[model samples]
Target: MTHQLTRRQFGAITTGLGATLLLAACGTSATPTSAQKASAGDKFKKASLTFAFWGNPVRNAYTDQIIKNYEKAHPTITVAQQPGEWATYWTKLSTQVAGGTAPDIIQMDQAYIAEYGGRGALADLSTIESIDTKPLKSTLDEGRLNGKLYGIPTGNNAYAVCVNKTLFEKAGVEVPDDKTWTWDDYLDTAHKLTQGSGGAFRGTNWFGADQELKIWLYQRGEDLYTKDGKLGASVDNLTEFFAFVQKLFTSGDGPTNDGYATDIAAAVEQTLFGTNKVAMCWMWSNQITAYQKANGGDCALLRPPSKAGSADKNGVYYKASMYWSISSRSKAPAQAGGLVNEFLNSTSAAALQLAERGVPANPDVLAVVKPKLSATDQLAVDYMDAIKDEITNVPPVPPKGTSTVGTVAQRHEQDVIFGRATPVAAAKAFKSEVEGLIASA
Candidate 1:
């Protein structure tokens, strides 16, 4: 299928078109321009700054509230906010970055940060003295590489299964006791849930072949790549992961390639549990709010199924839900730093960040917003609480070209699932493709 930018997406890009134009106005000189220098100085009474990000209603509401609160606190500064839907947000931002007209404060994705940061597009956040990261010590630590902090995690997320309990009960498949469930148990239950015409809305849905395979690799304490750009796990491991999904597909416990390709609407579409074809599926915990609002049904978070006999079962880790970072190229680094600090630390800001994005990164933010959470949001909070001990903010950063590799890995698995390649062939092709990307980078 061809991917074309939607009209809504085009409108969003147009809304932020001026921000990109401003990049040309601010030339690519090695040193700051006079206006840039003046921005650093107090030459103007009012300063205009643009902050760009991608989000849905919840994130927009939260961020808009934070901007209002910040404006109230700093009467002289006006923040020009630009937001687009997630599908096209990165493309717009990348265009602006290439043109040297990116926003002063950009909501950064963990995958792209290293690439942009390494290329001098992102600001060396460590040089900014105003941001007191001491309060966010743990979260900040994940953003660092080679002794420099590049991005601050806005919040952390984890991989988990979201189960439609009502469906499980209706299907007569016992909900596996949360603490004792293993991978085989989950798969068996998923198979039992599979029944009726068009698969009867039981079992799980693998929207993308890579999703379940990644979880499988995680369970086995292996990953797509090593820290130093070498192949980490064997082709056999990846092939085994693919074979498991192939079995699930054969058993009607998951979607077939045609099913996902023809029907699935990406993450947003999958969150609507009452579409009722999927009984249990993988998701990030932070998505509960959107899921609740979009589908408005009974669903609960569960620990991802573990590999029954795998040695390292504690593979689940605290993953980041993007981040906020100052551009190394920004003229007003202090102000940008101050803005990020305000967003993460202020009570009202915390209230704005709640649910729309994920759990607040700042303990203070969570405390202030705790009483204001909805029932669904509170459930997410409870899950976070239960898994808090297992959650460690490890450096989730991959090398500069990891996204390219990830894209290849995903496509390779998709092809394998569609019967375009054998599992072993897919594994070898993915490795070769990704290794070439890493080499080029």
Candidate 2:
């Protein structure tokens, strides 16, 4: 079986991250352009800054290479890289912030942007002179909160269904037309595949994810959060979503709770799709590379299901995969801002990093990197381009303490699946719990 970089594996690579802090001892604070020159006297000549991010080993390697190139270009600045897995990265960062030793630059996710920005932990990127905001004006605005730009969008990604063509062929189920397929078509296809596989396979492994709920809500002219930053989904929306998912589970068209637990607990390489036990699964477009590599099979990307013949098929949208932000407490804000500029706009860095961070947010960089991408990555880029005109406005930034909502949804979803709670009861409880979380925040 091919090895896939699962989230657990990514987070487990925590070695050597502490040594990055040692580089700070060797250099004096050098004057950086924009604000540092005006704030700090030119007494110190060298500046040492730490750029922290989380990713798989491949991302870490590319980031290290990019840092080397940046250092070679600016001899006065030395950048130490702090790499961690997603789960541990936040915990370590939170601890560092409490201790007054946060890294200068951070790789931020949209889910936590509001939480951190609201607490005044993120620096305003609008003041940075080196970062040109024109190319990705609309995308960059997704990172704004309270009339300030808190993060810079690194790249865009859309959710899609990744189909294992080999499995479809083996099961003799015709693939649905992604462009026109509705939720009813999706369920029918899934049922056909499950029955055709003689109980050896499932149709999909994505029923448990909250993203599906968001898409369903959007198709009904609602969203996960309202424009005013309140919980926007109604109980009817939640009940319908859970009921549909419950049918998929009980019908054996999707994974059972035990099967799901087993698959989800394993590495990505050992997932149902990777093992050819499922014909289709939902994933971010950016994950195609890893999923295909792990599965080692012919795969294709398709749009998610929408309501049939709905005049307003405004359900799908491109989301910022992640963002780059500067810490509010950094002593070398100018240097941090310059590094963010280099990461986003520098051709040399873009050439080296390519689409490892997802499609480049800079159109100039995208133009250069397009030809160099692998076939799978190019397909993801093309998918984003294809859907550019169809997607609706970006959803509201999640409110503070919004991260816990996923856990709550998962727990209640399992209750519905296990028949411990009716969909109506679970929906009411979920809404109350989430509203309380927001209230406490």
Candidate 3:
């Protein structure tokens, strides 16, 4: 009988696999120096590997096709596919790592690169001579930890404001020029959008995300994490950040706490922006396709607003959408690295995956795939290319244990918005909590 597995069921199954394998996801460990380094002329022996990734079913299908093509080219190697939703993928992978049965090749995220790479859970990609780093030289630095490359960027993305053009026109609002727009201008436009919609819609739905704070910090010549792995932005900067968000919530320019909660819980197809209840929202450039598909309207991408008088608008940077890394414990490291090289540089693989993962990091592959992208994807590509020269260097890879900062920021911001705490109090609490996390790590 054919059976479909629910997310919970899939997690349950993977949990058993993890226990048997003894894998731990993110934890403290001394770096291991035992992995065999691959030479340029090393030949991959015929082997089997388990490749794991987190994505929707559509992405799984695309990945399956790409794997099929890779197998056709190299018939001696076999890859077993393990796909799961993002919410549980890391947990399962961690368990597998601890059990020593981790997938051969892992789909990694920037948020946990420091955690995994620092702990020696990932193989150092610098030893893999088959993969070419020249095309994406500018982006390769993001996957580094202590000057060692652990992950290869699968694609590149950037944060931006996604607008429902149809909603903006219907509300009689002129789209602000992204080049000259400031944070104050963004607020005014949002307020105007709310008033024009006669309270039926909001101007934006993204006042609480930590990404906004990251951009704000960069604009002020600070960052979420310093190069030395400390909290870079001062407490006062965090206070201002929370205060601005609180103002947006109180001014009716954005969703209320309860409203925002409801919006977040809804499916993508039913989100406020998807339903045309918000004219704009902040999102990764790579997410434009799904947002536009859900909104069923003409969606436009705009750069995030800069500080009004600051001559240097350094808020923009290319972010690694995700990365491909091989587990250090993989029995077939050579074959696994070969697959990653193909995934990154093969023309056939790029043709099929296109920007589904994000814009191809390889310049040559990007050129080949640009014309094949959908309209919304083309917009993302053009947006990234246009801003490439203006953005600052990529921010430091998030420090170990720093992933919890996002949750802390969200909780404190919600508290301030709901009047449970003043912005200053929340900011102080956030600073203390984040420092504690970093110290504990």
Candidate 4:
């Protein structure tokens, strides 16, 4: 659910992509030369590389320490850190790539990986071997587009419902068995939590994000995009997706319109769930740490309610919370690969990150880090393990030209929720507009 750069903004970059060996798997590629393949992971060459990522101050400190430690390990290479906020990071990146001053190591996201890769801006990660990815297995597919690997997964995160045990306890309500919960159960619980507290705070937060919609679609054997990069969801599916979230507002079980905008944009510590204003919230697993820190209590993750009231039908899937990719423009591919290796596979680095980035994608690393993680982080890891069987396939790497999917989806869903548009009307407009966006891309 992280957006890289918008396609319109990338038009300038991709239009200049030449006969590329770095793009073999993403969008377009020509065969790499024997020399290029041979040099991919060559012995740590002496190179000063730049690494860029988006994060707040805490994550920045971790990256800074990781960089210092990496320099200590490989004295021959030096790294410069380029950190920015989410919006600013992508803006600066596009400018850098266009100017031929792109960083060597870049933290990537699923939403825009393909757009950047298709334009030949990322190295073919599959061509490199020194940076081992075997520990993560299939979760890496979230970074694969077209036919080749352009990005390496940093960790795995899943979208699910997080309930506050403290709120339930204060309301004198027993926590429902997530295993057998249905939509009715979810709605009922939200209502009871609200009523039990006499509206001191709302019951739940209503969100219509792509993650929330995908859970609903997956449970019904539907999906948003096909492997072929076309829309796989029907208008009817879109209608129901909007309709369901609309129930929260109509039933008076969710926050006010004024509060919805404010809460959704606030930090974890200031939001409803973070403030203990809601009994449950649908969110990415990576947020558990922040939510836990904010609430100062237990934040339990549960599988999203299913149609059949069974965990088997919950349709949860693991997504690489974020990723690492070597810039095609990098002069130090090996050194960049080494840095990514340190972040993803090094046990010491895993300890530094803990679950701040979600559960480590590598089981070997998780096995090492788990015992040392805080209780809330352990909760996240255990939740993922407990529901492994309920998970289906990893989501497809969003294809190039779909950068606006998340934004467009949220707008349409919000219209339905706020009663500004009917579900069916919003769905029709959403389908037409999204199709047009992809076509234009």
lDDT of prediction 1? 0.65
CA lDDT, every model vs. true structure:
0.65, 0.75, 0.79, 0.76
Question: How far out, in Å, is residue 313 in model 1?
Answer: 2.3
Candidate 3, residues 1-441, lDDT tens digits: the string is: 001233353345344533433333344232333235554444356889899998887789989999988888778888999998877787787777766777989998887787677766777887766567777787888899888898888998888899998888888999998888888988999999998998778899963555778889988878988877888878889999989988889888888678786775566778888888899987788878888999898998888888853323848778888899888877677778888888888888888888877788788898889999889999999989888878774788888767656657778988898899998999899988888877866
TM-score of each: 0.82, 0.87, 0.90, 0.90
Better of 2 and 3 by TM-score: 3
Question: Which stretch of 10 consecutive residues in model 4 shows the poorest summed lDDT?
Answer: 27-36
Off by over 4 Å in 2: 1-46, 309-314
As for lDDT, the candidate ahead, 1 or 3, is 3
Clashes of each: 3, 1, 12, 1
Order the numbered candidates by lDDT, best leading: 3, 4, 2, 1
If candidate 4 were superposed on the true structure by all CA atoms, what would the RMSD be?
3.5
Error of 1 at 412 (Å): 2.7
Task: Report the C-alpha lDDT of model 4 over 1-441, residue by residue, as the tens digit.
Answer: 344345554554444332232344454333233213525456377778899999978899998998898898878888888988886677677767655677888888777687678667787887766588788676767878788788877887787888888888888778889999998898899888888887676778865657776778777788777788877778898888778777877777788776777776677889888888887888877678788789876679988898889888887888887889887766667667777888988999988887777688787788888999878777788888888877775667766677767767877877877778999999899889877766765
Residue 56 CA error for candidate 1 (Å)? 3.5
RMSD of each: 5.4, 6.2, 4.8, 3.5
- The candidate with the higher lDDT, 1 or 2, is 2
lDDT of 3 at 336: 84
